[model samples]
Target: MPATAGERPLTPAGRRVLEVASALFYERGIGQVGMELIAAEAGVTKKTVYDRFGSKEALVLAYLRARDERWRAFLDERLAAAPSPRERVLATFDALGEWLRAESARGCSMVNAVAEVPAPDHPVHRVAAEQKSWLRGLYADLIVQAGHGDAGGLADRLALLHEGAVVMFSVGAMADAPEIARDTAAALLP
Candidate 1:
């Protein structure tokens, strides 16, 4: 159910279900929320939820994919606005800061999903790992473009800072965690 072949377009009700599920899944842990609550919140029947996503796992996957898409779009926009590679690398942190302040109150959704689904082989857990791995690779690519040595090492460090900031900002109640991470990452650069 994680990867449906030639997935059909979401109907309006399906869209509503996804929207509601995304919120509930992010705010509350995936294990804490159920199909019944998602359906009730979206004003759709449980059958409609099943019809749209096939199963709860699929719905969870859909929610993770949708959020990942949005975050990538946001980061892309910020990266595009930067004129240089170094600035672009920093732009990632800036984007994260803005995204955290504006949209994410509970830290990274992927991180939360991983916490909720501890089984490494689970589809949800795999998706969450993929998201984090992608971010690390992104940093590596950006650092390479910036002419940094040991892009892999520095990228790993920077990615940790970014992720740590998210958790600290949300659960640790450190309001300026992103900014602190950004400064530390900038220092690591040059």
Candidate 2:
């Protein structure tokens, strides 16, 4: 019988494969990395990699999912320490800044993956879109909690600023994009 959805658990070796793939995929563009490279670096055979993830596309989706999970955890941790809803919203930028500077100075993994993936219907592309939408929703929820009217509009503006900052930072046009974004977000908050 075929396995049901979500039935497969990641074994230790599979987790290692994902960890290596996540790092390689982030450091190098997705297109630059291949299953063989991932397998070699992960100390697993190409067959093992395929047996674990089923396909390269599946592995890419797993990598993005893992990255997204870590990102959300990081943002939540930062937001949790804020004393106010406004600070919580601003803290999201702070969290992003730290993440970009320390973990991924190159740019957003999702955005980068989207650029490499040729098809809109690819699992990685869907995951990337969902990640952005999740961030926008988080911003909107915080804005509402902070007593802001037109939370959706505010969220859209803030999300745009966030995306702009990431692009600028990635292109070396702005080293302090996150801080700048935070300040601009403050002004947007009524």
Candidate 3:
């Protein structure tokens, strides 16, 4: 979790719990993992898990948010290395490709979470929606920075390609899906 003012940093045990839970949650479905398992894997008591995270739902949210922070930082570094706004826009696909091969072997965390937590009213849905919104908004900003028209429309299209590529890569077993997305997005852009 990003340290907010007045919020104490995670204790060593808390950090361990988060790390263990993160792996378990991603490797196994959320419903399959329990607090007992998390505590056992983290070498903490069940009480410690509750003391640190309050509830299972809260812990899941923290895990999701932490993953989101890491991804944003990774994409930011890739975007910064690019020379122009257009390159930066394309950089997202390159970053996604690298991310898929290096980190996201199982697929998008948000998408997976949304599938597991299917209720539209669920907090997981909100987080997944927010992540998609951020991607679309990022595309829009890059489009405008490149002095392109229809930023909103183009951003929406790019976001779809980006998302579709992930599903194709993870579920369809298309290893080159991200490159395909990049090429398709390039054709869409001015």
Worst 10 residues of 3 by lDDT: 1-10
TM-score of 2: 0.95
Q: If ranked by TM-score, best first, what sequence of candidates would result?
A: 3, 2, 1
**Residue 58 CA displacement from its true place in model 1, Å:** 0.6
* lDDT of candidate 2 over 21-103, digit per residue (tens): 88999898778999999999999999989998888878888888888898888888999999999999999899979988888
For each candidate, what is the lDDT?
0.90, 0.87, 0.90
Residue pairs whose backbone atoms clash in candidate 1 = none
lDDT of 3 by residue, 30-70 (tens): 88999999999999999998888888987888888888999
- Candidate of highest TM-score: 3
Alpha carbon lDDT at 172, candidate 2: 95
Give every collision pair in model 2: none
